[model samples]
Every structure is written in structure tokens, then in C-alpha cells.
Target: MNPKATRWAKSVAMVATILAVSSCDVLPRSGPTKREIYAGSVQREGDAFVIAVNDRVTRATAVIPALGFSDSFRNAGAVAADVIRPGDTLSLTIWENVDEGLLASEGVNFTSLDSVQVDGAGFIFVPYAGRIRAAGNSPEAIRRIITEKLQDQTPDPQVEVRREAGDGATVTLIGAIAGTGVYPIERPTLRLSGMLAAAGGVAVAPESAQITVIRGNQRSTIWFQDLFDDPRYDIALRNGDRILIEEDTRSFTVLGATGAQSVIDFESQTLSGIEAIAQAGGLQANAADPTGVFVFRNEAEEVAAQVLGRNDLIGAQRMVYVLDLTQPNGMFMARDFLIRDGDLLYVTEAPFTQWDKTIAALTGSLGSVNALSTLAGQ
Candidate 1:
């Protein structure tokens, strides 16, 4: 061979050797070892920080009377609606023979009498009495009005009114509760806890559930924890009052280089990335890559890749933040970065060291296949 061609061939051989050696170090020998990929792909999710079992969350407890009237009883006069519910028995009797005496029987057994139903129109049907407004009127007031109308035909007739079977009172329970339906309010006043207890309390996930009160089109949210904290928020439920329990949908999941991988729930409207990391029990000592910490999230079109280096964040307005485990001051910055739901955090390992084992395995497999083919051909 010519000297120049021989030199060129030697240079090519050197370059090929370098590339082959580098590939061996770069590619993992094992089929993409799970531990290696997990170390790089895992991230913290959600806003709220996770507390230890020994750590006590700030909570309040108060002793409330089991059956005492709530302060809302003062505004009872303002309520003007009523509805008959199950488990309540109402008795209806007519005075003398003015209206055919529906309730009065000498020997005949009657399944139904002249009982009035507070129907959809908020009125009750009485025999020969037509539709009379019974809703919003007390039992005594209804009796007085009926007596006045019958006074002309009967001489000093006695009128009897009693709730024998159905009391015109009901409460509706909706949202994040095990049983969401119309529950009967046996008594006049029902406390917030009493209603929850009647409906099997809040749903299984009480921490992520909220209660809403819908009365006369006015809606108000009541936090389960807050209801336990503040007595003022615990309201007295009235007839026809609706209690809705709403389940919280916002949450974050922590994976990869975190000490603990768990789904963290965010009750607040917003959560920071740094806060999410801390809630995940900080980063693992061996797997955490302080310089290569990144958050992989889906943007409008492409995946938004944000790098959080140790010195990148300086202000609070920026959503992305990098944490430095080596420095004490970085702890404060980690606390500042808010985490959002579905946000993924990845800590990359040092290059060349990651897939060395995988590449070696692949190369060995290729070499074995080539040798097997050569042998078979021979």
C-alpha cells in the first residue's frame, strides 16, 4: 500500500477505536436499567408539602352542643319555604259535615282522608276547599283559616289538625358525600355536623372534600377543616336546604430522585415546584442531580422543558426554580418555587456514566449474533 494511504488508514482506525470506546461507556450494558431511568425521569408533583407522621398539622377542635339551636335561629322568620318529607306523618280532620267530613268515619275504613299535600305549587288540595296555600303557614295558622271558612255552615265546630304521618320538612345533600340524597330533618333545627352524620359524614377522602350550602339560590362553600375550626361557619340547616360536598380535583405526584414518591393533594389554588420537592421529602442523596434538575411539562404545542440550575432563580415571579442541596441558602429558594399539578421533575445523572452497562450489553449481543451467523454460514 502507498505510505499516504497507510497513514490515512491508521488515522481512521484511531478515530473508530475512540468512538467504539466512547459508545461502550455511553450506552448502558443492561436493557435500560430501571434504576437508572427512574433516577432521571422521576419528579415531584402537586403544591402542598408532605408532612411526617410525627408532624402535626395545624388543626382546631371545639366542643359543640349535640342538639342546641344554632345562632341562625334568629333569622328563622325570614324563611318562607316548606316541603313535606318522608318519615313524617300528618293527620287531617274536617270540622262537622261542612266538607263531607273526609276524616270523620262512622264505620267505613278509608285509606286516605282529606289530607293536604304541599304540592309543587306550594298549595294543598282539600275536598270542596280547592287548592289552599299550606306552605310557609304554621299548622295553627292553617287550622284558623280553615275554621273561619267553615264557621258559616257549622255552629261552633271544632277543627283538629295534627301531623300524623308526614311532616312537611326535608333537606337535600349533594356533592362529595357517600350518600347524596334528600334526607328527612326530624327536628326543626339541624346542625352542620348533624346533617353530615345523617348523610354518612363527608366522603372517604374528607381532606380533599368541601361542603357547599345552597339556600334560596345563594351558594356558599364550607371547608371541612374550617368547619371544624370555626364554629361560626358551621350553619344550622333548615327545611329544603341543600348541602353539597365537592371533591377536590387538584393534586401532584412525586417520582424519581425524591425521598418519597407519593401523590400530594393541593387544596390551595396554586403550588410551586420547589414547594412540591420539599413535600416529597427532598431529593435522594445518591440520585439527585442539583445542576441538571429540570421540569418537563406540556405546553400549548411542544413539551416545555425548564432547567433549574443552582443559580438560575433570583426572583419570585419566575415559575421555574433550581435548588442547590449543597448550600444552606438554596433551601429558601426551594421553598419559593411553586409546584402545579401534573408537573414532572427530572434529575439527570452525570453523562457517560448513565447508559454504560446498557451499551455494553447491546454490543455483546450484536457480537454474539454476528459470530452465530458466521458459524452458521460456514
Candidate 2:
């Protein structure tokens, strides 16, 4: 070979060797690789506590969001529809055998007194039945009282009473429902589930729906599906109750060698690890290491103790859970494992990915060198 060509070859070989050796350490990546993570977390002075994922580990960490009803909410009883209240509008009709009746016209046998409203004192005044207590009594009981009082003036008189639109028997239905406004409590809609159905159900997915009942100073929330799954959740609604339905607001952060690196909202009340990965658009097949998936969280001291099987750890401890998809039970473990709020789910790059980057860097460096050599020769 020519001395010049030999010198050029030697220079190119030295440059390629340097580039290959430094590519992995200097190259920009989405996140740290598995080896880097292991090196950092394996030491006693490490910042995070890393645990291998398994059946027992999953059981220890499978926690659900806090959602349930208190006794004050679950035990709030209902009011009867027949019982009259202040501010109620009463419709009354009177009937008599005689053509000229006390409350009827000359030829008419029956007469209707339209919209006789109950006073704030819970009393209604009829033609002959003066100051009747219509608030505490049902319509049938009030009708009988009116008939007895009017019989002296108009013999064998009959009375009918009906209750309509009152401030006393209504509730406010708001948030993620089709019909959001004040609704009356009567007939078929006396319970929580019935009122929800009357409002056209939840506007979002059933799994993501959450219901809250606010009764004065007390407030309680539960999964919307739980109202039907458990009868105890479907407590009787009371007057002036405010019911709200909305989607859950919990989410997790996805990073590293996944198809997407972003914040993902939970799809349901109970979100599985596999479901969370799928929501992140899955792991990047070209660069992801199946055995290096990890979940990082700041667990409560009590939860940390349960997870580590040792009560010595104190305060809020940082935890990392590893999931190896290569094992036979790995997929099942992932399926059963639960993802929680504010968690970090990451997939590491394959070891070969670093080497590939090194090789590509060397080839690119050689290409530039060859072009420079040709220019010099010219």
C-alpha cells in the first residue's frame, strides 16, 4: 500500500475505535438503561428501593383508590311522596249529589279549586273547611277531613286532593349526567340509582364514573358502578340533597423506551399493569428490553413495610418494581398487577441497542473521513 493511503487508513481506524468506545456514554437517549438503573438502585446508599415483581409482591401493592360512603351518607333515610309540606301547591275537587252544591255551580255536580297553595304555616283554607292542616297529612287524609267539614253545608260531599311541584321534595342533579338540573323525588325515582337512571345515566364510561352525594356539611363519594353492584351504596335520597357524577381524575406517567412517553389517565377504577402499558401505546419493539420494565413510586411507610416484609423502614419510601416479561408467569403477573396514581412506568432499552448506536457512530465517522481524504487527493 502507498504510505499516504496507509497513513489515511491508520487515522480512520483510530478515529473509529474512539467513536465506538464513547458512543453509549455520550449518546442522548430517552432515559437511563436497565444496567444503569441496576447499578444505581442495587447499592445500600441508593435513592430508590427496587423489588422484584411476583405474586406476593403484587398482592402487597395491589391498592385501589379511596372511594366509599360513610354511615351518614349510607343511612340518610328518604321522605314519603304522600306527605305534604310547606310551599306545596294543592289541587282540590269537590263533588255533591245536589245540582246547587256549596262549592259547585248551579247545574254542575263537581267543582275544581285550581292551585290552592299551602301557606308557610302549612295550612290551606277551603270554602267550608277552614284552616286545614295539609302539611303533615297525606292527600287521602286531607280529602276525608275536607269532606267531613263540608257535609253540614253541602250534604254527602266528596273531596279529592293532589300535590304538585314543591321546593320541599326536590334535589339537584349536576355534573356528568345527560340531564343536569333540579329534579323532583316522586313515583319511581326515590333511590340513588333510580334518580341516576332518570337523569339519563352517566355521560362517561361506567368504569370511570364517580358519584358524590353532598348532604349539607357531609359529603361522600363512590364508584358509580358500585351503586348497582352493592345495594348498600344505593342509599335513599333525601330532600335538598345534591348529587354529582364525574369521571375519575387519577393518572400515571409513562417514560423511557415506550411507544409514547406522556401522562396517561386511568381507564377504569381498577387499572392493571398490562392495561397501563397498553394505554401508553405499548413498548417500543425495536429498542425495548422486555425483562427491564420498571414501576417507580413514593409509597407510604405502611405500604413500604408490607411490600418489603420488614417494618424497619420509616416515612415515605421510594419504591421500584421490576417486571420481567421473559418469565412464564410474567405476563400473568403484569395482568394481575395494579397501577396507581402518580406512578412512573418505564421500559428500558435492550443492551444491543447501545452497541448498535456505537457501530452506527463509527460508520458515520468513517464516511466523513473518507470524503475529506478524497478532497485532499483531488
Candidate 3:
């Protein structure tokens, strides 16, 4: 064996070894394939989660009530428009008629008393009346209380109270909302939806949008859509209620030969195989190998692999599932297969094609080099 020949033989062997490792399809003999596991075809027999075509009814129907304003409005209390705040100024006025004959005949006459501003403590110091707590009470109510207090000293006292400065009420909106700020409370009562509308509604990311209401130290979640659908759930906004709209963070990734390869935002919920594919833009023409489709998942050391083929899953009883796409009817089942987060879907290509191309390229290169050497020698 010449040194040159030996070197060429070694090079061919190395290339062959590379080809061997990269070439053939490796199928699991005892367990389900990755595609079967992903498709959920392999599962324990009689498992409650695994339902067969026969078990699924064709025309299952039920009446679902439409979401409406009445539903949201139900049980919701009326919210006051004006929310009282500090630093607001109020005016109190007292009026009485006095005879004028006193000045003309050494006597005085008066028709009304001067209006006075209420102090910071909501107290009004009158000529004869003493200090009084008037905060939080309505203007009319305050007038009646003050008039009664002054009745003992002044006869027929007519009293009036009016807001002098500052707004009557307000509500605060925050978090994932289009517009968040302090909104003036106008009416005597307002609903949750009204406040949300004033704050520019909830800013929901396509899938999960929720509004949270915080009263005192208690918290409650409200569905944004539900507010429009069911009036019963629409809550009343109080003076200091904090409304927060938020977007859920849980999401999943869809990749490979599907139409779209991106992260899908979901509310940490289960997804079916068909739904996942649709989210990824459906299957690609050349990229998807229906029979070779696989899903890889793990439970402790026991890894489950699903293989999808013609129309039926091979091991429909185990945790692993096999979806058969060869038949036209298989699509329906594929759509029913559920998918979970962190699950990887691989669409396999036809076997031996890559190997064939690699070998042909190497042989062609060798032939071209040999021909050049022969020409140079000649």
C-alpha cells in the first residue's frame, strides 16, 4: 500500500463515518417516536384524557347566553360623580329682614346677612353662631344644620351653603390602560365601565386582558370583555378605588415548518395541536412531513414522544400520540391534539436524500481532481 494511496483511503473512511452518523433515520423501537409523543397518540389505555373519535360526538351543541350590558350592570351599585377632597372652599350665607324704621326714627333695618367663607376645618365663624363641623355633608344639609343651630339666637335665619373652590369628586385609573389618570367624578353615581371608558378603557394584549379593582386592602379581578358582555359584573367606583388593567405574562413558542415561528401569548392554559399549528401560521408545504411529525416531552426520566403518520395514531393509549396525516380524515384528529408550553415540534424530511447529495458531491470532486492530475501528467 503506497503512502499516497493509504492517505486517500483514510480520507474516504473519515468521510464515510461522517456520512454514516448523519445519514440514516433513527426510530425508537421500544418507545414511541418524538412525533407520536407530540401528537399525543401514545397514551395509557382507558386514560380519561385520551378520547377516541367514536367517543367524541359530532353535533354537540349547547346554548350560551350572549354577553350583554344588562349582565354587567346587574348587582352593580351606583357610583357618585363627585368625590370629595381636601382644600376645597365652601361659602355659608345667612339672611334676615330687619325693620328700617330704627334709622329714620333712631332705629336700623336690614334685609340680609353677608356671605362668609368656610375655614380650612370646614367651620364657618358667624356673628352669633359658633364653630361647626360641615365637611362631607351636602350643601343643603349643612344649611339646615346651621340654620337650626342659629335659630336659638337669630329669628327666621335663612341659610345657604355652596362650593366656592375645588372639584366635588375624582377617581384614579392606573396600569395597562390606554389612558390612566385622575378622572373627575361628575354624577351622583357611576359604573365601573363608565370609569374605564373615561380612562380610555383597558389596554389588553390580544389574548389576556384583566382589570383589577383595589378597595382599601382587598383586591378583585374583572375581565375586560366581561364588562361589556355582562352588566352584572360592572362594579361601582368609589372615591378612592384604584382600577388597574393588566396583561397576562404566560406565553408559548411555535417554531419550525409552521406558517409562523413566534411566541404565542396565552393565559398559562393548554393548547391543542391544531390550535398551535394555526398560531404558527399552519404547516408549510415542503417543511411539514405529516408522517414524520414529532413532539418531544418529558416526565421525570420517562420521556414521551409522539409520531404522526397517515390518519390514525399508532399508540393512542400511552402518553405518546401518533397522528396520521396520510389520510384526508386525519386532519380532524390532528386538530384535536393538545399542545403544551416548552413542547418542541419537529417536521421530518424524507430520509436518505441529504446523504445521497453529500456522497455524489464528494465523488464528483474526486473525479474532477483526478482528471486535472492526469492532464498535467500527460
Candidate 4:
């Protein structure tokens, strides 16, 4: 071999060896493994970080309630029962046994009245009936009240009340919908999901969407998937309710030795750690360390304080959670582990993968040097 080629070969091997040695020290090899993190070692202590595998998460969840539908479904039953309110418009028709009646013409027995808007006092002004209370009563109930009041003025008076628009009882469908408009609550059974369908279904897949309900002073949100999976979330919409279908911006990033590295949108408002891994195409089988799957997230202040076993972690941020899929129990735990919005899921490369990559790189460099030496001899 040429002296220069030999020197090149030696230099390439030296560089590869240094790279391999440096790579191993980049991550700790002995202190703890994925199983340890999975088994309750989450905390922020000095320079170390870990997660607890027990009741801590449940407690945190209790403090921070699930967003959207779960919190807002309590009013579904009452909202489903439609009731008239101020700002409602109604059309009244009056009929009398004789041509000479108060509401009907002098020669006519029937009269179709004009539409009237309910006043702020929840009353509608009628010609002879005066101001009739209409709010808080259903259309049928309002009609009965008007008929009873008209009996004195007409001989056997018959009254019909038809609602033109329940101004206060409408749901405005907005954002990421096939159609956006104010949908009147004709019936009490108009549910959250039903309204979505009536508005020409969803413009985007619900899996990656969130449904927000904005009522008078209350606003809540729920994952589209969760809304469909549980019938309880399909709550009835009320008047002046605004339903918004928006794409959930929450995401989790997969890093390190995964089949692919990308930010995955939470198809639903809630996602499990396992599901996140699956979305990332799972860890690279050959390069992954089965015991090093980890999820990083910023926990609530209280939860962070508890996990770190410290009293002063008021606003601590970011902690690591590990899952060891090599064990059967690990798979079960992963399913229970919920991945929050803005989380990071990483699967460390197997320890030897570093050495393999380093060796391959060195071999390529040496091959080029050898080829050059051979060509010089030729």
C-alpha cells in the first residue's frame, strides 16, 4: 500500500473510533432504563428527571378536568327541551264563530295575523289580547295561553301560533364545516353531533378535529373522536349556542430511532402514548432500544412538584416518561399512559447501533483510500 494511502486509512479508523467512543457517552448507560421510568421514577431532581408510574397522573387529571364535551354535557338534557325566549318571532292566526269578532274582520270569521317579535319583557303585543307572555313557554303552550285570553272577546275563538324564528334558540355552526349558518332549534332533540350532520357533515376528519360549544357565558371543547365514541357527549344544543369544529393544533413529536420522525397531530383530543408511537410508525426495529422508549411533557405545577419530590417546584417544566415494550406489562401500561398536547416521544437507538454506524462510515472512507492506491499502482 502507498504510504499516503496507509496514512489515510489510519486517520479514517482513528476518526471512526473517536466518534464511536463519544457517541456512547452521550446517553447514560447504567443509572436507569425505560422500565425504571415506567415503574415510577419520574421527577425533576437537581440535574436528573423522572416520572412516577402510579396514582400521580390520576390526581393530576382530577385537578385538570378533561376539556370540552365532558365538562359541558351536563346541560344537554335541559337544552334538548326547547323553550321560547325573548327575541322569538311568532305568527298568530285567529278564528271566530261569527263574522263580527274582535280579531276577525266585520264580515270574515278568520284572520291571519302578522309576525311579531317577542319584546324584551318576554311578551308579544297582540291586537286585542294585549301583551301576552310568550317567553319560557313552548310554542304549544304559547298558543294555548293566547286562545284562552281571546275567548272573552270572540264567540268560541280559535287561535294558532306558529313560530317563524326562535332568534334566541339557534345554533351557529362555524369553522371547518361543509356549511356555516344559524340553525334554528325546531325541535328539542337537536344534539351537538346531529347539528354537525345537518350542516353538511364535517369539512375535515373528526379524528383530527375538536368541537367547541360556546353558550351564553360558557365555552367548552371535546375531541371529535371522543364525541362519537360516547353518546353522552352528544349533548343537546341551546339557543344562542355556537358550535365550532376546529382542527386540534395539539401535536407530539417523535424523535430518535423511530421508523420515521415527525410531528403527529392528535387525531382526537386525547391520545395514548402507545397510539403516538404507532402513529410515528413505531421505533426502528433494528436500531431501537426496546427499553428506551420515552415521552417528554410539561406537567402541571402541582404534579411536577409531586413527581420531583420537592416542595419548591412551583412552575417546573418538562419531564420524561419511559415505556419498556420488551415486557408484556409494558404494553398494557402504555395503553393507559395518556400523551398530552405538545409532547415528545423518543425511542433511543440500541447501544450497539452507534458502533455499527461508526464502523460503516469508516469502511467507506478506507475503501476510497484503497481504490486510490490501486489506481496509482496501475
Candidate 5:
């Protein structure tokens, strides 16, 4: 080879080396490389703590978002339908066994008392029964008392008491329900689940359905499916309860070498790490580094301490949990691992993927160099 051609060959080799180094930065990759993430996680306190996921890590990080009712919500006893209270209107029918009965007209055998309102003092006035305690008693108890009191006034005075207006026994249902309105707490709709059924169930999917019970100043949210699986969550419905039904707000971000990259909503009550990846279409076959999957999350200090086996971490800690799919127990670990809300699932590109792109860039650069050498007639 000519001396000039040898020089040109050396120049081309140097230019290719430079291009390979610069190509990685300019390449259209999904996210950071495995080495880059490891480099960034070197400082454990200020930066993200890089922890390789295993059985211990999976157990430590398996925290699922809790859905439950507080003590005030569950302990609140239900209102009785039959018990008479203030603002309740009672209807009384008095019957006598004589031709001219007392308190009844000249020849009437029965006299119907309508719109008989119970006063704030829990007493209702009757013609012969006098002011009786109607608030704390049931309809039957009130009827028996009235019959006994009116027995002397008329011969065989048969009395009947019916609750006409029970305005106190009611609950309001709103949001993500087929029927969003106030429903009376009848015999059939006394419990939380029963009242939801009476309101036509939840409008959203069962997995995404969430019910928030606002009783007084205290409020609690629970998952819809928890009623059947966990009986303790289905609390008793009380009067003046405002129930708001809506969808669950839990999601995770999918990025890097996967089939698709986007924010995915949680589809079930609990989501495993592998299940979440599958929902995002799984890892990219040709370019994904199976051993370099990472889950980035902002873990609470308590959980972070448990995960790292150290109690020095404060407040919310940044964490990068690594998963190596090449290992024997990697799949099992991922299956047991749980993905939390706002977590980022990332898979680094294969080592050869960047190399392949670098070679393509170098190959293109060589063509232009060769053409320049030809024009110079070297």
C-alpha cells in the first residue's frame, strides 16, 4: 500500500473511534443505560439507593396501598327504622265498640288521626292517650301504650300507629353510580353494600371502583371488591351518610426497552411486578437487556430502612431496585414483587444494541471520507 493510502487509513480509523464514542449520546435509545443508572446510584443518601432485588427485597417492598374504613366509620351503629324520633309524623286510628264513642263523632266507630307530628321533646298528643313518649319507642310500643290509655274512655278501643313520614332515615349516594341521589335507609338498604346495591351498584369496573363514606366530619375510602373478600370493610350504613363512589387512582410509568412506553393504570386490587410489566406489553425482545430491569420508586423512610437494612434514611427516599432476569430465582422474585403507585419500571437496552447503532454511524461516516479521498486523488 502507498504511504499516502496508509495515512488515510489511519485517519479513517481515528475518525471512526471518535464517532463511536459520540454516537452513544446521540443515539435514539429509550432511556439511560445500565452503567449510567449504576453510576448515578453510587451515593446512597442524597441519590437513589441501588438495591438488587431478591427474596428479602421483594418481601420488604411488597407494600400494597391500603383501603379501609376508620374506627369512627365502622363503629357507627345503624339507625333503626321502626324507632320513632323527632320530625317523624305518626298516624293513629282509634276504634270504639259503642254507638257513640268518646273523641269520635256521633255515630262513627273509628276516628283516624293524621299528620300527628312528634314534637322536639319526643312527645305526641293524642285525644285520649295524652302526651306520650313516641321518640324512643317503636310503632308497636306506641300503639300498645295508646290502646291501654284509651281503654277506659271507649269500649274495646282498638288503636293502630303507623309511621307516616320518616325523614330522618336517609343517606345520599353520589359519583360513579347509576343512581346518584338521596335514598331512604329502608329495611333492605341498611348496610353499606346493600345501600350501594339499592343505588344500582357502581358505574365503574369492579377493580377500579372505590367508595368513600363521609359520615359527619370523618371520611374513609374503600375498594368495591373488598366488601366480599374482606367482610370487615363493609360497614353498617347510618343515617346522614354521604357515599361517593369513584375510580381507583393508582398507576405506574413504563419506560425504556419495552413493547410500549406509557403510564398504565392499575387494573386489579394488587399488582405484582411481573404482572405490571406484562400489562405494558412486556420487555422488547430484540433490544431489551433482560438482566437490567430496574424499578424506580420514592419509598417511605420506614420501608426504605427495611429494604436497605438501615434506619438512617429520612422522609421519602429515592430507590432503584434492580432485577436480573438471567438468574434462576429472578422470575420468582418478580412474581412475588409488588409494584406501587407512581413507580417507574425501566429496562435498559442490550449491550449490542448501542454497538449496532455505533457501527451504522461509523459506516456512514466512512463513505464520506472515502469520497473525499477519491476527490483528492490520493
Candidate 6:
């Protein structure tokens, strides 16, 4: 055989040998795809941390709606006006018929009554009326009572009454508010919006604000966005109500394979799963496994049991919620899925990426062998 042919044959044989050896450790074409991570033996059910595998349609229809609580308060009007209480200040003016001929004192046709504050016993002492129960009575009702009492002495007296500054209901504002103090409810129609306005508005943007109302023994929280989205959330304020405006520093962490991974603050009070992912710069198209998207959250014991489909009550469950973005309705379900504070969203690497990496390494060795063959042939 010719020397050149002999060399070419040896080089071809060497190349075949390298390829055969490399095939031993080569990545399997497709042993198990990314979907196996969700259904495979690695992540089976009955573990301490239950994995809830929910499709887009099931999550969007059932789980998403159950995540949020209903708004409890309603619009009852600001400064509950009909009820008067102790500590209220009242001002009165008295006038008698000047034309009456009876014991009407010449110099005293009109009297400017002294301003009175309702005592702890719910009574206010007027000069002639003396120890009137003013706490539960409206200003108009008080005026009538005073006028009727003074009619005999002053002759068909007319009385006018007005509540002083401390007479009406008020809401106390605190934390991240322009003016953090007690503000009087000036109108009967005053609402959460109006009360916030009276307090000089919020120090931060509404999207990043949380409003909490402390009424009696119960406390309720509402996102600033929800307050803006629905008029029904702008409920009326009551006396001694404490309105706390807090900056929403709550956030979630993104990990695994994504465009950006960090603990990101929610720009608004409430955020959907899709919005949260977008905030984190979305998933990396090349590295991310769309079927292996997972959200890790430590849910309440009862809620976790219900979500995990467990009958017995267990401890606080750390839930791993899986969503398959490869489906058509994935994005729609994500839009409805609410992301809470401290949630960890992870996009596992695609299974084929391993194969690609392995192949690239094999190709580099083949290139080196080809270069050596070319040198030998020369």
C-alpha cells in the first residue's frame, strides 16, 4: 500500500478508537427528561416536606383562589357622628324673645354660655340647665333640652350648640406617614382614603405600602394596591381607631437557574408568581428547566396539611410547590398564584444541559486528535 494511504488508514483507526472510548462515559441521549424530577423516585410523596405537583389549570382554578383572605371591613362613614362620648367639648349660645314683657332682665337679652367639656360621668353643667347628660346626646338634642329648661326664666329661649375640636371621632396614624399623629374625622363621609389624606398622606409610594387598621380587639391588614383597586376597601374610620402605615419590606429569594438571583423586595403589597419571576429578571432560557420550576414556602400547619392532602394535623410544613411552565396555561396560572414573603423560587437546570456539556468535552478531545493526525500526515 502507498505510505500516504497507510498513514490515512492509521489516523482513521485512531479516530475511531478515541470515539469508542469516549462513548463509555458519554451522556445518555435521554434516560429521563426534566419531567422525571417531578414524577421520579427522587421526589416521591410522604416525606416531611410534601411536594404538591399541581398543573396550571388546577392551580389557577383551586389553589390560587384559596391563597388570599377576603376584605372584612366596609364603608360605614367617617367619625361615627351619631354617638357622643365623654371628653367631648361643647359650646352653647342662648337667646330669649326681646319683645316678651315678663321678668326678662333688661340688660340680659342674650347670654353667651361658657364652653363645657363632658365629664367622666357623661354630664356637662350649664349655668341654669345644671348637670345635663351630654355624652350620649347629639348637639341638636342638647340644644333642645337647654332651650326647654330656660323657657320659663328667659321666655321662649332658643339655644344653639356646637361641638368643639375634641368633640368628634378621630384616627391615630403611625409609621411611614407624612404626619404621624391623631387626626380628627371632620366629616361623616370620611373613609380610609380621607383619613390618610388628613394625616398628610403616605411617606412612601402606595405600591410599597401596607395599611393596618387596629379596631378594638381585631386587627386587619390590606395592601395599598388592594385599597386602590377596590372602593370597598376604603372603609370608614371610627373613634380611637389606630391606622398604621407601614413600608412593605417583605420580599422573596430567587435561586437555582434564573436571569437574576437575589432577595427582591416586592414593589407592591401583593405580587403574583409571574410578576415575582419577572422582577427577578425571568428564567434563563438556556439553563432553566421549565418543567422543574419550584416555589418553596413554609406554610401554616393547617394550611400545609390541606394543601399537601394530609388528614392528620402535623407541624408547620415546608411545602415545595411545583409548576410546569412548558404547558400552555402555565403563565396564566402563574399570574393568579400569589407569591408571599420569604418564598424561594427555583428553576432547576434542564436535563439536556448535562448532555451538552459532556458532548462539548468529547468534541474538544476529538479536535486535538484530528490536529495530531494532520501533523503526522504532513
Name the candidate, 1 or 5, with the larger TM-score value: 5
Per-candidate Cα lDDT values, in order, are 0.52, 0.86, 0.53, 0.72, 0.85, 0.70
Candidate number with the higher TM-score (1 or 2): 2
TM-score per model over all chains: 0.54, 0.92, 0.58, 0.70, 0.85, 0.65
Q: Write the per-residue lDDT of candidate 3 for residues 1-378, one digit (tens) a residue.
A: 466765676566556655544543432122333333345432433321222221131111111222232333245567433222344456655665444321122243332333444446665554556676655666677777777876776567677666543433556788888898876554532777777777776776524677777767766775576666665677766566777778765455654456666777654234555666666677777545566544433321111212211234234223323345665766676665555545555444433433445566657656665565455445
Q: Which regions of candidate 2 are displaced past 4 Å?
A: 1-13, 42-44
lDDT of 5 by residue, 196-278 (tens): 89889999999889889998888898889887788777788877889999898889999999987999999998898889889
TM-score of 6: 0.65
Give a tens-digit lDDT track for model 1, residues 1-378. 566755565556555544665564454332223333334432544331212111011110011112222344324442322333333444566646434444445553222444554665556655544566665566677667667765665555566655533444667888778788887664433566777887788874666577777777666675576677777665666667888787766676665566776677775544555667767787666555554454443322111212322333333312222335445655444444445556565544434434444456556755665565445445
By TM-score, the best candidate is 2
What is the Å distance of residue 217 in model 3 from its true position?
3.4
lDDT of 5: 0.85
Question: Which stretches of candidate 4 lie above 4 Å from their native place?
Answer: 1-65, 68-84, 99-108, 119-155, 177-179, 189-209, 222-238, 312-314, 372-378
Ranking of all candidate structures by their lDDT, best first: 2, 5, 4, 6, 3, 1
Question: Of models 4 and 5, which has the larger lDDT?
Answer: 5
Q: How would you encode candidate 2's per-residue C-alpha lDDT over 1-378 as one tens digit per residue?
A: 476886877687667667565757676577888877777673656788888898888998888877899988787676787888887888998999798877788889999998898888999999878989989899999999998898888888988899887766788999999999888787677899999989899999998999999988889999988998999999888888999998988999999888889999988888888898899988888989999999999998988899888878869888999999889999998999899999999999887887787677767767777776666666
Worst 10 residues of 5 by lDDT: 14-23
| Decreasing TM-score order of the candidates | 2, 5, 4, 6, 3, 1
Which is better, 1 or 4, measured by lDDT?
Answer: 4
